[model samples]
Target: MSVDNFCETISDQINTGILVVSLDFTIVKWNRFLQVHANVTPEKVLGKCIFDVFPELPKKWFERKLSSVIQLGTQSFCSWEQRHHLFELPHTRPITTDSHFMAQNCTFLPITSDNVITHICILIEDATDVCHYQTMLNKTLESLAMANRIDGLTQIFNRKHWEECLAKEFSRARRYNHGLALIMFDLDHFKLLNDTYGHLGGDKVLVETSKTIQSLLRLCDQFGRYGGEEFAIVLPETDLVGAADVAERIRAAIEGTDINFQDQIIRTSVSVGVSIINSQDKRYEDLIQNADNALYKAKSSGRNRVCLSTELP
Candidate 1:
């Protein structure tokens, strides 16, 4: 086989775009891979200057590097990790491919004759698929993160998410010198209710309670089930008085109605503890403990009452 036929055979078998250009950046040859990748046929692109055909090619960038290749006969390679050449392609070509089609790796080799640069060989490898898969993997990880923060039963924020949310709100409140209120509460004799009725009936009460509390809350409020039969609420921009008022409203709502569980009417009440932000408290445990203390006060005084942390005196 002749040398020309061998080169054609090699070009046709390769997946990478292979092309040759003159020292002036005029296309001297374009292989079949280049034709498919570029969507430009040899007849149209041959003998044409690179910028004249793709006018958006960064003139300054190419002028700087191409001048070096021409003058110094330096063979250079560019990785997609550094910059993307996808923008250089026609908009139609980009859209026809999937979102993952942005990998662009190219090598520039200067063919020298007697220490003078005569022609340059360009090789391009398409890595768009690899990049697309990476983006999809990242999105999957994000979804997992969201799922980990949700409670399995009520599909609300779980305890871990509650802590994260409280920390962020605490920072915001301290920065703005605004009020932050925390309410802690538990069902009165939850163990008795669970024992008298089965675990399923207790679950019904918990679910209904979540709904009731959520209805009373604003969009900015954050609530989470603290533990078995216990829950907590974080209210940003609310003072201690405001927190107590909200807690009473919750207690009243719980006691005002009976939850229907398998033909039995279950009556229940909640003991609440309320606190307002006075200083920059970093950990949620301290605020939770304070609320628990107030809740203990309410439980001791009367199971259905609301107690405030500041009302300890």
Candidate 2:
């Protein structure tokens, strides 16, 4: 077979679309793949301006790319990620969802004769399956990460994740010498509620209390289930007074909220302790310990009250 026949055979047999355009953007060579996918014949498109044939094409963008290849003697590439499709080809994959056009990655190569650039060849590769797989993988990874960080019952940050956030916030506050606060709170007489209403009723109280406290806190504040019925909160850039105010608000909210369980309304209250980071604090745990101690004092003095570590003698 002749060289021309070999070239024609390769162009027709390849899966990718190939189109050759002159410097004036006139279609010079339209391969079979392009003819079938674009629903245009070579006889009709040859010697015609490509933009006129496909008016939806990004003319200015393609012109710049073509000019670069012609002037700089280099190639250009466009991925499916950057641009979905160069041509509105029919979707052939029936199993894929939310896809209408064939995703494509395109390449532009300069076609030179005797070192004088004459035409540019555009090659298009189908990338639908690859793009779909990548999107699905990303969503799966995101769901997995969320599951690991969130508490199963409370729908809030778990103890381990909350501790990680506290450590980071503590370091940031200490490094910048900014104010930070910790609040530890738990239900008063939680065992009594559990015995009276069973574990399911106790769970209802925990869930409702978590939601109430979360609604009262700021977006920057971190609230998490430390363990069992106990919870902890991290307040960045907040001083002792601000932290105490937050604790009081949460305590009031919980006391006011009535959790419904099995046709009965159960009321509960929380004891809160607030502690601010001080110059003498060595680690994040030191702040937690102070808050815990203050919480103990609140429970001893009276339930449903907020206490500050600084106020303790």
Candidate 3:
């Protein structure tokens, strides 16, 4: 076979699309792959301006890219991630269900005849499969990360994740010398409710209570499930009085909200403990312990009220 026949055979057999254009953007060579994918014949496109063939093409951007390759004698690459496709080819791949057009990764090579650039060749590869797989993988990773941070029952931040948030908030408050407060609350007589209403009913109560409390908190406040039937709230830039007000509001909201379970209206109450950050406090654990102590007082004094750590005798 002659060298021309060999070159023609290679171009026709290759899966990638190849299109060569001169310095004037006129088509010099149009390979079989380009003919098949672009639905145009070499006879029709040859010697014609590329922009005229594909009027929707980004002419300025394409010109800039071609000029760089011709002037600098360097290749240029375009990934599917940045631009989905240069030419709007039909998405015929069965694997790419979500894609509307063929995703492409294109490379521009400067073709030098005798140490002088004469034409630029564009090589385009179908990247639909790779792009689809990467999108799916990213979504799966995001779902897993969200699941890890969320409590299974209440749909709130899990204890482990909430503790990490508390530590970071503590460090920020200490560094800036800003006011911060912690609130710890638990359902009053949650064990008795579980025994009376069963585990499923108890779950409904917890979910409803969490939603109610969360609705009353500010956007800056972080609320999370501390444990079974217990929750914690971190109030940034809040003093004892502000934290107490928030705790009282949450306590009232929980006490008033009724959870409907098994065709029965179940009423529940919460006892909240409020503690402001102090100079004596060393770590986030200290704030939590103080709030826990106040919560104990609230439970001892009554069942549905808020108590402050400083009030403890």
Candidate 4:
């Protein structure tokens, strides 16, 4: 066997697609992989312009890539990450994967003859599996990050996430003097209620109460589980009076809800404290402290009621 015949045998056996094009984009060579995958024989595509063979291909962008390789006499690359495929070829396993077209990572190789670039060898590799795995990995990471920001039982923002939101809202209020309010509330006599019902029942109560509160909240508002039997709400574009109104609604809503757990009915109430950002408030912690003091007052003066720091002595 001769050297040229030996090279042709190797190219045909390889799984990758190989096609050589001249400066005018005329197809000079097409390997076996390209023939099978593209469903075009060498007799049909050879000596024809690549654009005429693959009309759907990105013409202007591909010209730029080809021109650069020819001028520089260096190899260039086209990743699946940037553009999905160079040729409009069907995937090998379209039934299994989401990709309709074959995911391809292509390389533009400068075929040099005596330092003058004569042809451009385009190598196409199937990247469907790699693309699928990468997509799944990204989604998993997003789910994990989202889980960290949420409370497990209630599915609302956790304490840490809630605080982060508050800090951002507080900064906005300070900068633009936007109306912002914070409400902190805890279930009234939660320990006694837990004693009457099991821990499972308590979980039910928290979940139900959170759902009820969420229904009344705006999309911009942030609600989160503060701790055991406790929850907090940050109301954007709301003032002291507006927050008090919201707090009252929350109190009445909870007082009305009758949670059923294991065929048993459970009634619950909450003591809510509301506070709005004031000029004297230097940090978000100050808003938290004021709301906490008002919450204490609500508990002391009989639970299931709303109190406001602005209204306190």
The local distance difference test score of each candidate is 0.81, 0.91, 0.91, 0.93
What's the TM for model 3?
A: 0.92
Tens-place lDDT per residue, model 1, 104-136, is: 778888888897778888877776665556657
Using TM-score, rank the candidates from best to worst.
3, 2, 4, 1
**lDDT per residue as tens, model 2, 1-313:** 9999998999998989898899999988888888887788899999999899888789899899899999999999999998988777765685774778888999999999999999999998888888888889989999999999999999999999999999999999999999999999999999999999999999999999999889888998999999899999999999988899899999989888888899999999999999999998999999999999999999999889998999633
- Show model 4 residue runs off by greater than 4 Å: 71-74, 114-116
Ten contiguous residues minimizing lDDT sum, candidate 4: 304-313
Off by over 4 Å in 2: 1-3
Backbone N/Cα/C clashes per model: 1, 0, 0, 0
For residues 92-118, could you state the per-residue lDDT of candidate 4 as single tens digits?
778777878889999999998998889
| Residue 163 in candidate 4, Cα distance off native in Å | 1.7
RMSD of 4: 2.4
Q: Which stretches of candidate 1 lie over 4 Å from their true place?
A: 1-9, 19-29, 37-40, 48-123, 167-178, 215-220, 252-268, 279-284
Candidates in order, TM-scores: namely 0.68, 0.91, 0.92, 0.90
Candidate ranking under lDDT, highest first, comes to: 4, 2, 3, 1
Q: Pick the candidate with the highest TM-score.
A: 3
| Candidate 3: tens digits of C-alpha lDDT, residues 1-313 | 9999998999998989898999999998888888888889999999999999888789999999999999899999999999999988866676555877889999999999999999999998989888888888989999999999999888888999899988999999999999899999999999999999999989999999988888888898888999898899999999888888889888888888878998999999999999989999998999999999999999999779999998532
Looking at model 1, residue 45 earns an lDDT score of: 92
Which pairs clash in the backbone of model 2? none
Candidate closer to the true structure by lDDT (higher is better), 3 or 4: 4
